[model samples]
Target: MDKIIRIGTRSSKLALWQANTVAEQLGHFGHKTEIVKIDSIGDIVLDKPLYELGITGVFTKNLDIALLNGEIDIAVHSFKDVPTKLPEGIVQAAVLKRGDFNDVLVIKEDENFFTKDAAIIATGSLRRKAQWLYRYPHHTITGLRGNVITRLQKLEDNDWDGAIFAAAGLKRLKLLPEKEKHIKLDWMIPAPAQGAVMIAALEKDEDILEACKEINHEETATCVGIERDFLRVLEGGCTAPIGALAMIFDEEIKFKGTLFSPDGKNKMEFYKEVPVNNATDLGEYGANYILERGGKKLMREVHDIEKSTLVYSTKSLSHDQTNNLSSKIGVTSSDFITIRNNRLKRVIVKKPIKNALFTSQNAVEALLNNFSRVELDFENIYCVGRRTKRLIEKKIGKVTHIENNSEKLADYLVKNLDTKEVTFFCGDKRMDDLPTTLLNNYFIVNEVECYQTQLTPRLIEDKYKGILFYSPSGVESYLKENTANEIVAFCIGETTAKKAKDHFKNVVVSKLSTVESVIKSVNDYFQE
Candidate 1:
């Protein structure tokens, strides 16, 4: 405490503000602090985006090196810029209380960009770029790389309609424009520990570490810990397009995370909340939730975007499935629907049930994912599709009945089902025909939503020779960002083919209702 703590920070005004704030906080504890300015690779490279630099902790590495050499007792950094894993011999000393984590849009013109068909928005961060595009797919995004002031100046010199920035930075430096000129993007999730400042110290330096702990905010630390854990589990580091934010309230912690492809074409996201005691691994669990559903494959696509593909699957496929296709037809895939088991766990039945129904494989997987086959048993399993029935038989039990579509399934259930009560496992966006029919037939339909399906529409930059759609939802998700009237539409069944016919000039339905059939149909069409 008696030694003067040397605080290393980037030379940018925003970083200096962080350092001076740290120095002021340390001063109150009777620890003398000296500000040592440092230049980071991020500051030196103004022409390239941070992700393009291909370096981890570009803004904090220089200061970290200074700390490692004992030139500075502690290194200050915008917590988001710090890698989830610290450098060797470096440990986090403190995390100050977080500031405004909302991203703000500084508009050079009016606020009509959202309604317009096309408008130019600028930002250097890939996370921001992707989120903006996901919301405004019709709008144009341009790159602007520099420090806060420099980026603002570039906006002034350019013809962009608006640019994005962290509200904490503009508010900390009192550079936030008037309310009319700027709007808060409340929907945008901030980077991990975005508005917080971090103090890094040598693990052996007990004095500095001890002194810094006095300024550590435990609540901020917990929230940022969750956010950073989510980021680390995603394995994106700083180079990928990822965003995460965590907040605590009323003895409960809430978290939200989003992952995007490198080109910002595809997106995956999850949100969860838990009691304070159960919040420790919530971030890790959330990341795993998406990964199991489809995120792992999407990230692989992001990492290998340079590879060209002639076919794009709205749903992710297994290694064998992709290899099932001829190597001559390169395929790229991502799950357009993010499947989540939020309702699956709570709605699981531990007791034996007479009649159970599944409309899609997603419902079967979602139910089995949270509740094991040993947990519950069903006497009669009636599913709308063969694949769904097969999954039920493989994972849980035998399927007594199977139908091609919901209407047929409803007719079969009404005529054959004698049970007064039936439980239907399905996603959030299921058609109401089966449930309505059962209800009208005086049956107690327990429509337990086993999973929630969210559509993640990604832009398809190039039209392939053909587009393969497994369901009407897949076709709808694809049409959100692309038109395929001229491209061949290979569908798994007549239901999917009917949907494709509305959007495409040519539609081909597989002879069988299966993915293998769809693939073979595609091969046959291209072969001809």
Candidate 2:
């Protein structure tokens, strides 16, 4: 091309490296190139996680603006960071050949973090965080944000066990530490388009777009296109913990996609192999298959979890708890926060049961898992929360009664449910008042150990204005790694407030025990 192809990119070191790479590729085509470094909002704000910023395309928005303003002919981006929808008048020009797509665990030499229970792991990606927790629920995940070198420096400066990084980034920058210091996390699925580099040019700039296409890798584009299509169909964008990959194998395309609950305790996955000729709609087909197989409900629950900001619940909230808050308050595209540092200890129950009582979804899941092992003739089922009721109803067809609290459930059972025998599925760490009330009321309660709540506290690297707590156990978990130095405590109810008051002077209690009320309390306190 006769005109100089100005490439716009973020000023970060890694971003400049990516821009230079594209410039080098275009140079081979006898095209003149100019590198323009720009600073994005994502790079400017380092205090909060990217999702909390309430903006999509945090890293590429500035470049998009630059390209539209005619300051640059083309914008280069890490394909994964670019929003699925491009800005007006801008279109994808080319996708360079992809690099290594695995996420690597970088640690100090001879580090014992992985072997230790509840070791601190640092990452800024929700996808990485969710997958890591799903595999190693015993470890705690802390937020790590910065440029490639800055994040590595932070890992060296802090006492954190280890941090995660993209294998492609390290290879591009040639900054991979010793083999002993980094371990390839092959088991974890990578984000869609993770290792690919993308270039965008205005639709009217045919000269630059045509020149860019000369270097486009058709195979790389096809693979990432399918993966991104799957992501778009699922509405994951950049917010949800969704992963998809499409690879051409022996004239066929093999695809794998995964979706996880916000807490990472539950997961759904789908895999398929199809001819490459029919690969255009493979992503969409895979998305629908997973959604039909309980992935739809999991996604809704994840959406609810993402709508809140820094909720520390003792137990994972049910779909109803999260959905109620999402409905009452607006869930922004960029505002989703959940910090679940505890894991549920799975258990087995072999007892015969006629009626089942459940206070949490964890309890209900335990019973559902053991239903096939034992001949359960459950005539009636009583649950304390809407999420538990829905779970049981999906499995057994119906729930006899559902209430907001255990006390209400006990009262309803005493007046309405007349089954002589009952089986209560409960956690090891549970409130004694509900079981005590039932045992004293002449109800033959056969307590079955369902699950145990294990605390895995994370290291708090950044300071927030306030912390939201839903249970006394949540308060206890937060205190394990941090103190209420200047931060306010927003509690779900009086019981949680009492626990927060022991350490924090500025403790505010919500009027009701709901996620919406807790968020309201936070807003009111901050607005003051």
Candidate 3:
């Protein structure tokens, strides 16, 4: 502890501040420290974005090399810049106390600053650049590479009106010049590990690792652990504009994650809070929840953007017009009227049915509307998907069975129940997989067509250069009526793409079966 420990850090002002702070903390423990300033690859590159540089240890690689060579006892870094995968024999020995992990906008003090259009903003991160451009497409973002002071100096010397920086960095260095304002979380999400400092040491250097632990903050470590774990599970890095932040208060932890399209036009945000006792499981649960809802699709699309892919996909169904399919399949003439009138009935029904099966929310809506006055006795309500489950619970009360796919739902009902008299409230042209799967196990399966799906001619003409098809029926409708010149066709899955390929020779099928996979495929195609 008496020997002077060499602390390696970047030569930047911000890195100096971080190193000095750590030195001060270590000094209290009677540990002598010497600072070693080094230049990182990130500091030298000014032409391309960080992600384009292939963001693996651009900042820490040199410091890590110095540490392994015994030139420095510890290497300090902005935890967010550190990669999840580290070089062998090197480890993040301790994470210093976290700071304000939020993105802040620093606009120059000018009379017309708030009203300016197409304001020039400076930023070095692709994640921030993509999100900002998506939100304010009119605003121009120019790359400003340097330490905090240097960037600010560049901002003043150039035509840039503002710049974005991590609030934690400014707060750590006390660099806010009173003219700058901090942006809120609603506007911009901070990068992962944004506000934390990491102490990296040789794996074999137990003395330095143990000494560094005295300064590690437990709450910061736990919260960052959860956030980093979420990032790791998502397989996201600074390159992908994914944002996640965790807040821990007492025994409760709240996590919020956002996935934005590379261009930032389409976005999905997820929020969930769990008790601290379940913190270890929080990352997986949050990830699974996002994937179930739509995060998986968004991620694939983001990756496609990086790979320069164009995506054209849709969720509409395709039908065969020549086969008199409309008549053979049950078609309701007054379907809209039925749905509208039933929605206004404000009636609740209790039917004494042994089993209740649902295909869509419309079924639950119809049952609640028409049979509201009737009392039906059912032990449980089974739904085909999460959306149907939520709808049933909202209208009819809690549902016991929830399945991800329709086929899975059918398999579940067939395996669990012994009764044959099951009532399936569904549409006129609903898929038969669910009923067919359950028919063998039930005495009598009753399917009541509650509504109908009719094609509308309300199509927008040739507005898009590409079309995305999710169902075969959608492809049929587009091919039957609309004629466009050579538009790229993208499908969500193989089943949809097969129908698309029959009509269009230029059909692209997504490798993954989900919506995100389709989007990614489209992006990759377009970019290519």
| lDDT by residue for model 1 (56-96), tens | 45677678767766778999989988887776677999999
Q: Per-residue lDDT of 241-285 in model 3, one digit per residue for the tens?
A: 677788887689888776676666667676788887668856645
Q: What TM-scores do the predictions have?
A: 0.56, 0.55, 0.53
- Worst 10 contiguous positions by lDDT, candidate 1: 41-50
lDDT of each candidate versus the true structure = 0.81, 0.74, 0.67
Error of 1 at 431 (Å): 44
- What lDDT score goes with residue 390 in model 3? 70
Query: For model 3, what is the alpha-carbon lDDT of residue 163?
Result: 85
- The local distance difference test score of model 2 is 0.74
In candidate 3, how many Å is residue 455 off? Answer: 33
Candidate 3 residue 286 Cα shift, in angstroms, is 2.9
Measured on C-alpha atoms, candidate 1 has an lDDT of 0.81
* lDDT (Cα, 0-100) at 349 in candidate 2: 32
